[model samples]
Target: MTIILAHRGSAGTHPENTMESFVAAEQFGADGIELDVHLTLDGDIAVIHDTTVDRTTDGNGRVTDFTMEELKKFKANYHYKHFFKKTARIPSLKEVFEWMKGNNLICNIELKNNELPYEGLEEKVISLIKEYKYEKRIVISSFNHYSLVYIVNNWPEIETAPLYSDLLYKPWEYANSLNSKGIHPKLKSVSDTIIKTTMENGISVRPYTVNKERDIKRLLQINCSAIITDFPEKAVKLKRK
Candidate 1:
């Protein structure tokens, strides 16, 4: 079966990367949740996309420019403020880990370091997963192959995948060379040949941001390993049919 992972925890319905979003994903019976992480100025991990909070939050500044304490003060639902009356703030990695520990769900942790490399970020994230004993339940992905390389070198047991939006020369070969368990490419970049080649090499081909019922059916027809989507409810229902 093609597993469905809630991209940023059902981002289409709830505020992306918020606790409510994650909870809603779990409630919708998604197999896992995909979230982004960035290192804060105080050396803590915050779960929000982008190098800055200007788009998603009421505050205006880079994510790394503030400490975790300072970031928690800014409401994360600024963009959804007109529609969503509830409140949500930027969550720490620890907070997310704590909530996930009680659930029987998996999490894909995307290291948001391609634009701004966060030194020791892999270690910090791995340390938290270790603390929660979530090694088997986690998948690490990044656009920065170098970051994934560093992660695989330091912690060989952790699972890491490469995230790319553009077409590659030979993605499966490159992922295999780096000992990546899986390759995450944009849904648009994947094709029958890419899926076959990846499966031939014993590497999983899980693509991202796949919305629309027709696309989901197409990927499922090709027997994809997983589909990462903004609406897990729709994907999950379609997968069942």
Candidate 2:
């Protein structure tokens, strides 16, 4: 079956990356939840997709500029009235892990690029994964090849996937060099030849942000391991049809 990965936790219907969204994804029968992580000023991991809180939340300034305690004051989305009729706050990574403890769902954790160099961020993430004993269920991904390579080299037991964009330099070679288990290309950047070559090289290809039924079917026809989508319900229906 084509795995339905809920991009930022059924983001189309719920607030992205909040506990509510994650739980909603579970209720909606999504196979996995994909969320982004950024380290706060106080050495805490915050579950957010961007470097700043201005766009997604009611707060301003960069995520790295605030302490976790301060970040708790900000809401995850200002437009979540349709789902819960109330505001939701950003969730911590540990809180998310606790929520996923017994659920039969995988967690796709994307480590967002760093704004300031932090020592041992990768180690910290790996430690948390070990602490949760989620080695089998968690997949770490990053657009930063350095971070991805660091995880690949130091934590070989953990699966890693590199997020590729149109600007990637020799994308295949980079993925191959890092020994990534999978390659997550932007939906538009993916092609039949790329998928075929990636598979031939023993690397799985899973495209991101694909919501349309025709695109989902096309990717499946190319043997994509998964399709990360905002509307997982629609993707699931498409898969069934």
Q: Which of the numbered candidates is closest to the native, going by highest lDDT? A: 1
Among all windows of ten consecutive residues in candidate 1, which has the lowest summed lDDT?
192-201
The superposed Cα distance between candidate 1 and the true structure at residue 229, in angstroms, equals 0.4
lDDT tens per residue, model 1, 1-241: 7889999998989899999889989998899999999999999999999899999999999999999999999999888888888998899989999998789888999999989979889889999999999999999999999989898998888999999998887888889888899999998887878887887778888898999899999988888889899999999889888
What does the lDDT read for residue 91 in candidate 2?
88
Backbone N/Cα/C clashes per model: 0, 0
TM-score of each predicted structure versus truth: 0.97, 0.93
**For residues 181-219, what per-residue lDDT tens digits would candidate 2 score against the true structure?**
888889888777877777777777778999887898887
- Scored against the true structure, residue 77 in model 1 reaches a CA lDDT of 85
* lDDT for residue 18 in candidate 1, whole number 0-100: 96
CA displacement after TM-score superposition, residue 168 of candidate 1 (Å): 1.4
Candidate lDDT scores, in order, read 0.91, 0.84
Pick by TM-score: which candidate is best? 1
Task: Give per-residue lDDT, candidate 2, residue 52.
Answer: 89
- For candidate 1, the TM-score is 0.97
